[model samples]
Target: MSSTQLFRVSGISLLLGALISLIAVLLSFFVNPSFTAPPATFQSPLWSTHYSLFFTALALTLIGLPALYVRQRGQRGDRLGFFGLLFIALGTFLALGMAGYFISVLPMVAAKAPQILKATLTETSFSIFPLGGTLFATIGTILLGIVVLRAKVFPSLVGILLLAWAVLNLLGFALQSGLLAMLVALLSTLASAVAYGWVGMILVQQAGVSGEAAYQPQTALR
Candidate 1:
């Protein structure tokens, strides 16, 4: 594909990812009333909705990876860019795993105690999944952000935001508190939206133009 086409595809991927994430954020509140409240207990409806959104977001974020791969492969910075792609893949998997765990557990919990929506915090089958998933996703996003920044394939601002998001995610994990983690997660989501939006706008502007016509790199030979 031409450079313009590649960019357009990447831009579309980013926008889709952003849209899915936005939906997930909105669904979180409706699916689980406690989502707005302190993370005291998990509710079936809420957990279900959360998992759905998480998975959808994961799918959207991942859709862009291949485009990035095709653009970077065989290029000057293949090694670094490839590694970044790997990180994004890993993060996406972890995020999915987190969502999967929640989805699996909600049914069982609901079946046993349909009436009791809230339960005390305790070690359960579902709890660990989010923890692991969040960890991987956070790490992956951070790496992807760095790659984007270094590759200069997209705006540097997006990379910076990704880096900041990763740091926030790590901080949230370190705290091991729900409210804190959610807050950090929110920051990450916001940063992602901004980054994606920027990429989309750039792509739309550059569409139908050849890469050479749009971006001309200076070579040392010159």
Candidate 2:
């Protein structure tokens, strides 16, 4: 396929991935909580549904990364773009691992003990996975913001928002209050998604330009 075609596909994939991820985020907060909770234990259907959507988002996001990489490669600011991709990949992995551990493991622990084991596992998961994942994700998102700003592939507004989002995420980590942390995390995730989605859109447009340039006649008919 031509560069234009590739980018077109990339744009659609990126948008689709972002949409799925947004759904996953919502499901995590809403659907997931309903499952395997008190009075129900190991009988909630929401748990399985939540896990399914979470994994779906994970898979789609991972698949979208390669398309992004292909779009950025060979560009003028390729290095920064490539670095951005690296950061994003690392962040994605960390986030998924943390989320997976919480959704999969915590449920079982809560189901079995319901008191001591549940609380202990919850504390352990938050202290270890969330803390570490947030740190890694914050760094990655910040780097990605820098790359996007420097490359000017997307709107400057998106870049600025990404940087701000990264700062907010880092602050959330430091504060450690449930309400405050959740608020910041939500903002950061949404902002980062917008930035990345814009990048994908821009890449798609550039691909069309690239295709046109490639087909232009060299040395006209002198």
Candidate 3:
């Protein structure tokens, strides 16, 4: 109903999404013992967990992050924040498209005709977008983190965490073929969860306080 209420709802949604995504990532590890498994891996029960949870994560992020941005930017006319939100929205949409296709279409196709799994899987790699949705999201996160630091809306630590997460991811991607990259990638993944969780907690705290006082935009930092 109110701006504060919206932020609180967004925060809760983000937390739930982060939790689900973390579980999915964890379950994926136990499923095939490989970071990038073949289509056959999708036949396992964990497939349901992986696909459904990732899709849900992107969906929630699509809604939650934008709302969080709104609460932070408000009517101050922050251009950096606005662009950050736009990039996030675009990336999330692309990710949702990719995830939805994999979850809904790929499995069915793989089930009905196993022969085409190889071709289909290659055609539908998660990083289907030109620049890649993950990259877009990562860049957007970095931008948002910078905006947070400049605005001081949330704890600067949250911004630092986000920047660290993005840098880690970028490094991981660059050295993805190496053994050390795996470790770096793992750290990056965990950082992502933690970053979102921290932001969610901040939002929840702000919402909790909103009930006591009229929702003032500047009051969020307090």
Candidate 4:
């Protein structure tokens, strides 16, 4: 009901999201083997569980993101943090849709429209929005890293981890063709989970001390 309570809830949500997302990332390797392949990988029994966990992660992240920025930006405002939150929120929402499709629609497609599913996996260029969402989220995270350093809301290590995650992902995506790239991509996910977890812990600590600190402008949309 109060600002402190809201922040505490947000912190818990972020921590839980980070944990779930990390688990999903780990399970994905058993399913996809490669970061960019989805052709035959979807047949794995873990596919649904992986995406289900991913969906839950994104949902929790979305819920906590507002408080993340609110707790850091203070009354003066930081445009960078606001935009970062906006980008991440939009991207996560899009990714959630893709996860839902994977969990629900893809199965039906495989059963009834095998050809469609095959094409969707092999040459289906239309389903690129999930990639787009990832891009936005990555960029947003990088921006947030910078904002963190500037705001001094958390330890410098937290920002460094966030930056590392984005940079590694960028490296992986740009390389796009080697075993090294895949490893870098996987590292990026680990860095992301650690960064978020660290930040969430700090947020929880801040919440307890924030006291009567009610932040206005709940979201960038306002």
Candidates' C-alpha lDDT: 0.63, 0.62, 0.71, 0.76
Best by lDDT: 4
Residue 32 lDDT (model 1): 42
Q: Residues 1-222, candidate 3, lDDT per residue (tens digit)?
A: 787788788888888887877776666556642324566766666776676787897677566786668767753336887887788777777877766766677667667887877766555564464247668878888888888788777777877888887898778767643456656756765777777777888788888887667746558878
Q: How would you order the candidates by lDDT, starting with the best?
A: 4, 3, 1, 2
Cα lDDT of model 1 by residue, 1-222, tens digit? 766786687777768778778667656444442322433335446667766876876676676556655554664556666666676677677667756655675466556764443452243454454566566666666666766766777778977987887777677656654555556656767777777667666664566455555555544335
lDDT of 1: 0.63
Prediction 3 global C-alpha lDDT:
0.71
- The order by descending TM-score is 4, 3, 1, 2
Candidate 4: Cα lDDT at 20 = 92
Q: Which candidate, 1 or 4, would have the higher TM-score against the true structure?
A: 4
TM-score for candidate 2, residues paired by index: 0.69
Candidate 4 has a TM-score of: 0.82
Candidate 1: 10-residue stretch with minimal lDDT:
32-41
Error of 4 at 104 (Å): 0.9
TM-score of each: 0.70, 0.69, 0.81, 0.82
Runs of candidate 3 exceeding 4 Å displacement: 32-36, 74-77, 123-127, 171-182, 214-222
Indicate the TM-score of model 1. Answer: 0.70
